[model samples]
Target: MKPAIALPLLGLAPLLGASDLLVKALGIALVALPLLSLFGLLLPVLRRALSGHALWFGALLLAGVLVGLAQLLMQAFAFELHRALGPFLALLALPCLLLVAIEPAGPGAGLRQGLLFAACALLLGALRELLGHASLLAHGEWLGLGALHWQAAADGLPLFASAPGGLILLGLLLALVRLKP
Candidate 1:
């Protein structure tokens, strides 16, 4: 039998564990599951809107605005990593624009465009996290964040948080985005 089925038969809590891994898995399931579902529902509509190259361009511009707003909010909160958000947002833009750029002006293009932005965004986020962690290891601190010791063991590595499992969620989002139409 599958683990999900066997776990209950064994009288074990499916969520058993005190490790950060359990917490992170729970966090991703809680947050990303809904987001993925919503994206799936919204994909068709977004593809329709992105039918035209002009519309695609406009959407990219809007994504830029949204990313900017996200950064602005991060800054307003006095977040230590405010500067990093801009680069991450920019990284998101790549896949968003790629869908439009690669799109051929014809039928079914709408179906192809929906999750491109989200995939690009996730990939960029993962890359950012990895690069950030590497930088932290090299310098013993996150670059541009001064000497704020972002303890890797307890908190997380620089590229992404550990418990929350942001990278896994990111990977899932990318897979969802790349789904065959």
Candidate 2:
């Protein structure tokens, strides 16, 4: 599958997790981008050590290890952020594995995909926080930072904070991106 299409699909879990809070989204992006790029850079070295099914399994193992390490670091430095991520943190490995299995493997491809994912996560997170709660970075304290709440004049649409609503928004956003000129 094309990275453009595959990434958004595989990233649905993280997107939902991120959509609830901007700080969580930032954390997800910060952790994901580097880990993915590192995975891409190390792909060739792993390929040289294993082949066929072993390569696939080994790649997944490496991705899992990276994800685990990231989780540990998040837990250490940002415990609340790590707790907020929950299962979505583990699910991150799925996208990494997919990226590795896809064509045009390299640091550049990983970086491109990472940027795309980060943009989507941040946009969705900010929009949801704004629309659902009438605020932004309401949980900034999770990262030991002061909350950067932006209160709106009126009430927010509540739906944007939920999974179904996020899915709807994601569909609309993806549709907009895929539109022809």
Count clashes in each candidate, considering only residues at least 3 apart in sequence or on different chains: 2, 0
TM-score of each: 0.34, 0.90
**Each model's Cα RMSD:** 14.6, 2.1
Against the true structure, candidate 2 reaches a TM-score of: 0.90
State how far residue 128 of model 2 sits from its true place (Å). 0.9
Off by over 4 Å in 1: 1-43, 84-86, 98-181
Point out where model 2 deviates above 4 Å. 1-8
Error of 2 at 113 (Å): 1.7
Q: What C-alpha lDDT, on a 0 to 100 scale, does residue 40 get in candidate 1?
A: 35
What does candidate 1's lDDT look like per residue over 18-48, in tens digits? 0123221222222222333333343345667
**Ten consecutive residues with minimal summed lDDT in candidate 1?**
11-20
- The prediction achieving the highest TM-score against the true structure is 2
